[model samples]
Target: MDTQKLTIRLPESDVQFIKRFAEEHKTTVTEMIRRYLKQLQAQHIDEADAALQSITGLLPQNITEADTRRLYADYMMDKHR
Candidate 1:
């Protein structure tokens, strides 16, 4: 796969921390950043899956508009409580 260069500006202290962390893990700062970004993407996917699962079959098959509104209101109230 092809890759492109990214230039980022960070505080000196943060740069030092990243350098120290890379040395301790025997990895480059670029690799650490890539791993962190992949981890974040995985976490976002997991959260989306959870949200979809939470709403699965939430409404009844024959629910009317009024019933849907009432159900939504109740759900919101219960969530706040």
Candidate 2:
């Protein structure tokens, strides 16, 4: 995967803690942060999917994506007329 360097400032204590933890875990700090950020990203995507699923019941079972698109197009045309 492509990677970019990021720079950040932290308290000396936090920096030391990360170093100590990384040594104990036999992993680099970069890998630790990568796992943390990936989990946050996954949570965001799961939340978005849940939001869409929650709204599905509000629409008619017989309606489809094409029907929704056509209806939205008609509404926009009327709105601008």
Candidate 3:
């Protein structure tokens, strides 16, 4: 993979905080940022997969056409909360 250099500017206070955190963890600031991004992406993928599974399970297999439509409409309007 090809790598490019990019510079980012943060407030002095934010930089100090990140520097302290990275020092305590014995890791670089870049690694800490990368780990945080990966965690966020993983959480997003899991949520998307769960929503897809739930919607797929709602598909009708042996119901009449009219009943299927009604069921889907109700599912859309009904809030779990």
Instruction: Identify the candidate with maximal TM-score.
Output: 2
Give the poorly placed runs of model 1, Cα more than 4 Å off: 60-81
Instruction: Count clashes in each candidate, considering only residues at least 3 apart in sequence or on different chains.
Output: 0, 0, 0
Q: Model 2 scores what on Cα lDDT?
A: 0.96
In model 2, which range of ten residues has the least summed lDDT? 55-64
TM-score winner between candidates 1 and 3: 1
What is the C-alpha local distance difference test score of each model? 0.95, 0.96, 0.88
lDDT (10s digit) by residue, model 1, range 1-81: 687899999999999999999999899999999999999999999999999999988877889999989988999999999
All models, RMSD in angstroms: 5.3, 4.4, 5.5
How do the predictions measure up, each by TM-score? 0.69, 0.73, 0.66
lDDT of 2 by residue, 20-77 (tens): 9999999999999999999999999999999999997887899989999999999999
Please give the TM-score that candidate 3 achieves against the real structure: 0.66
**Candidate 3 ranges with C-alpha deviation above 4 Å:** 61-81
Best by lDDT: 2
Instruction: For model 2, name the residue pairs that clash.
Output: none
